[model samples]
Target: MYHYDEYDRALVFERVAQFRDQVQRFTAGELSEEEFLPLRLQNGLYLQKHAYMLRVAIPYGTLGARQMRTLASIARDYDRGYGHFTTRQNIQFNWVELAQVPDILQRLAEVDMHAIQTSGNCVRNITTEAFAGVAADEIIDPRPLAEILRQWSTINPEFLFLPRKFKIAICSARQDRAAIMMHDIGLYLYRDGRQQMRLRVMVGGGLGRTPILGLQIREGLPWEHLLSYVEAILRVYNRHGRRDNKYKARIKILVKALGIEAFAREVEQEWQHIKDGPAQLTEAEFQRVAEGFAPPRYAAQPDGDLDYGTHLAMDRSFARWVSRNVQPHKVAGYASVVLSTKPGPAAPPGDLTAEQMDNVADWSEHFGFGEIRIAHEQNLILPDVRKADLYPLWRLACEQGLGTANIGLLTDIIACPGGDFCALANAKSIPIAQAIQSRFDDLDYLHDLGELSLNISGCINACGHHHIGNIGILGVDKNGSEWYQVTLGGAQGKASALGKVIGPSFSAAEIPRVIEQIVATYCAYRELDEPFVDTVARVGLEPFKERVYARQPEVSTCAM
Candidate 1:
């Protein structure tokens, strides 16, 4: 994990002081709600359903044991006893007091963390693969690059107020876990024929009302020019991206309006000027930042028989979890463990209690190295858990209400705190998740179905990542009633693409049934042992859509 130096320390302290004054003004009525909106948002404070929510950043999904402990402590002391890890690898503390925000931020800063640039339109969070350093397939660690971009984008004077929120992701691995293709700027680290590190840049990919896949402008650019290249793209977007309509504001729209060829030309022209400029990262700076992410030394254990083959031969539940939750690591006998926040019978997805947070920290220290990573899939990642000790860890986790063993199953849903919490939501999404969970309770059925991501958001902000879900559900208010618009076949990977809507919107009551029908459709068409994503991709949405909408009650219809 990268520790905050003096400059980082000063910046956060000063920002908190500024925000405290702003909050005081708002509380005292010196500043109107309208005036305080942007300021509060910039500080990662959101006035939600019943109370305020404070989102804190975990840069590039990296956190030390001490920082993890601090987070648990803050969750225990300030608000609830747990925090919801987000798709951007950040954590949010709901039910926070409006007056205590500055104090909470100060506590976070004490542990070398803050919420700056976690919100507002300026580059929300520079995310990367959670398993950056330890992944066996990585060409170069993306954290240092993510940090460099984070520094450059953090309240940059030029991009403070973009038309809409901007997201950037870097993937250094052979198989992209970062979901880089669905971001404002997606960087794929690659080694060229010359054996030098470079990036395959994808620009303007996002998911909202109009989901757009990014257009690749630069391919195989030298690694030294990463920041300068990114800046070139941002400058072009900042100059020309729409500010008129909120729905049409993302760079995706701009890229679409201008064809990929034209957009590439524009970026090329911009890069010609900035490619070798001062913003271009120097070798020393890159090395300095890279050093911060060097893997911690572990006492070499005996390379003995730590076989999970015996366990796989026995416990079915353990095997299932191991299949979905474990990732290959560079170090032998070590594994990257994904602690799923999604639980069965539809407990609130991504909602963690303060106790759970504390337990997570304890478990991390006891089981693995004192390190934690948060995945972009709204789950916690213990970067280095030993394979041999997983049973004890799983048992302890089950006790603390942390074990679910439903990592990639249908019950593992990604739902926004919709109309229940968010003021902007039109429908209640949590109950829908509950409904689906109850309907789909059979683990055998789920396991058979395999690796389906169902996401629900109140609206098109795609906060729940509905756009990227294998089964994406969006809530809409149809004549003062809540209805869901579902999308199918979307995926988040190296070949990432947005899901397409499956026919008309379904009433609140019909969502679970529609999902059931969709699942059934997949079941009918799937080849032997094929995942739902693969089945859907092989067989288009028409088969699923027809089955889902066959018996729907009277409703208006339009092309999906």
Candidate 2:
């Protein structure tokens, strides 16, 4: 966790005072709704269906125990007694008073956190792999670099109000947990043959109206040129990216229209100016950022009688959870635990009560390092749990409804806060997701349908990441009724691919059945131990499309 310096403190103090004035003006008649829109949005305040929603950034999804406690307090004092963890690893309070936003931000600032770039057209949170510092397969920790970007991009003067929102992600690990390829700017850090660290840059990956897996434009960019390279790419996009139509404004559209070669050339031409500028990080600065994130001194040996096998023998459910949710840590005896936010049929994907947040904080402090990681898949990670305390921690999570045995299983769904909360939505997405969850309630059945990413969006804005799901369900409107279109074989991460629609959209009522047909087709055709996504890629979408769209004249074929 990066601590706030005096500079950070002073800047946030000034910004909060500044926003307080803006809010007063807007509340008075000095600013109209039209005039206040961008201003409020810049402050992470959005006018939603019934109230304002405030999304606070949790940088790189890392939260200290105290920061977690502050968030819990905010939920209890400011909004309703809950907070929703976003897919980007941020937290959003769906019901907030616009007037109180500045106060909330001030509190966040006190904790060295703010919502500065979590909203508006500026670059959003710079996410890294949740396992950044602790992953066993990592070449280096990416969090310090992520922090650098966060500081540089926060309230940057030139880049605000860009063509559309930009996302940047970095993965230091060999396994791509960050979903870096699905970002506007994705960086892969690796050590070259000389044992020198470098970055591989990918640009224009996003999931929206036109989903695109980013193109790798530059390889082995040395560590010194990172900030300059980012500045160059952003400047190019800010200058030439689309703004005429909202749908065509993302960098993905620009990359698609200009082609990767041309876009890369444009960025290179700009990079010439700032490649060796003052902003290039020196050894001291990098050390300052890196010092805050050193791994905690762990016990040399186990304090408890170490026997997870005994717990597994006592509880099969606990065994299943440990096998699925636990992950490897860099430390010898420490493990990272994935706390499933995706639980049952009707439960919201990432919503957690204040009590639950506090409990997580307590558990993090009690058993593991007082740090938490929010994953891109709408789950929480206790990144430094002792190998001996897995069962007790699992028990606490179970009591709080945080223990869902499904991690990569079919029941672990990624969905957006659609019509239920979002004003931009055309139809309800949460209910549709709930229906799908209920449709496949059997854990054994869902597990058998292994590693399926079922992403649902209420509408085409694709907030629920419908573009990248192995099975995507997108909502549409037809004669005042909501309908859905299913897409097969979309993926995000190292081997990234966007899903393709099977056919014409099905009515909302007919969607689950359509999905069932597609799944059945998969189950029938898949080789032993093959996942749904693997089976789809191997067999193509023809057989499933044919089964799902049978007897429907309106359905049309689309390629994956």
Candidate 3:
């Protein structure tokens, strides 16, 4: 985990003081709603359905135990005793008071955390794979580069106000766990034939009113030119991206208008101006940031734990949990564990109580080093758990309700806090997610369904990343009521693809049955051990659509 330098501390404290004044002015009526809107957004405060919401950034989804404890304290003292982890690997406190936001910001700053650039038309949190440093298939750790980007982009005057929010992700592993193809600018970091680091850049991917997978614009870029090349891309987007309509403002829209060749040409033209400028990353700077992510000390042990094998052989439940929750680590005698937030209908996806946060913080230090990670799937990661301690850790995790053995299963649904808290939501997302989870609570059945992804969004903003789920459910607004539109064949990773809508939206009550039918259709058509997404691709959506709409009356499709 990266510790804040003196400059970092100063900057955060200064921003907190500045925002404190802004909050006071707004409360005093010195600033109008329009006037305070941008200021508040810059500070990561939003006026949602019930109250102010504060989104705190967890850079590249890494957290120290102390920082996690601070977050737990904030949840306990300031707002409700919980916070919601988002698809972007950030956390949200839904019931914050506007007047006390300064206090919360101060507390966050104390832990070297802040809400800066978490929202607004600036570069949002830079993200990579949660298992970046330790993944078995990792080519190189991308965090050092991700951290460099974070330092450069935070409050960068040139990009403070773009046409729309920008997102960047880097993936260094063989498997694309970071969902890079779904980002505004996605980079694949790898070594070339000469064993030199290089980056392959993709541009124009986003999911909102329009969902488009990014197109590869540039490849074989030297690693040193990361900042310069990224700057060139942003300069092109900043200058020509649409300003008239927010709907058409994303870089994806601009890239669509201009073909990939034209877009690449524009970026190249811009790059020629500053390709060798000071923004180009140097070897020293890279090392300075990377030092923060050096590998933690580990005890010497054999490749596999004897006790771990015994537990797996002795306890069926432990075996099941290990199969779903445990992931391979590059280091011998170690593994990464995902603590599932989507346990069941009892909890909303990505949400954790303050107590839960504290327990995880303690477990991180006790089980591994004092570090934690947040996954894009909205789960917590114990990145360095020893295989020998797996049984006891599993017991503790199960007691804390974080040990649901459903990593890629049907019930581990990702959903946004829809009408329950967000003013932007068209319908309630939590209930629908709960409904689906309740219907599919059978673990044996879920595991048999095999590696399915179900994501739900309150609206088309795609906060839940519905566009990339194997079975995507999107809430839609009818004349007055809420309905859900379903899409199939969507997936993320190396072979990412956007889902296609099945047909007209269904009422909230009919969603569980609709999902059940979809699963039935998948089971009937699937070959031996074929994943749901693959099956959908092989047979197409027609079979599932025919079964889903057969008994129900035809209704007009809702305008997205």
- RMSD of each candidate? 3.7, 3.3, 3.5
Candidate 1 wrongly placed segments (more than 4 Å): 303-312, 552-560
Candidate 1 per-residue C-alpha lDDT over 282-376 given as tens digits, one digit per residue, 9 for 90 to 100? 89998887787778776565575345566767888888777777888888877788888777553688777767777787888888777888887
Listed in order, each prediction's TM-score against the native is 0.94, 0.96, 0.98
CA lDDT, candidate 1, residue 162: 88
lDDT scores in order: 0.83, 0.86, 0.93
Question: Candidate 3: misplaced stretches above 4 Å?
Answer: 552-560
Candidate 3 or 2, higher TM-score? 3
Q: Order the candidates by TM-score, highest first.
A: 3, 2, 1
Candidate 3, TM-score vs. the true structure? 0.98
lDDT tens string, model 3, 439-486? 888898777667999999999999989999999999999997999999
Best by TM-score: 3
Q: What is the lDDT of residue 288 in candidate 1?
A: 84
Among all candidates shown, the one with the greatest lDDT: 3
**Root mean square deviation (Cα) for candidate 3:** 3.5
Alpha-carbon runs more than 4 Å astray in model 2: 302-306, 550-560
Model with the higher TM-score, candidate 1 or 3? 3
> In candidate 1, where is summed lDDT lowest over 10 consecutive residues?
551-560
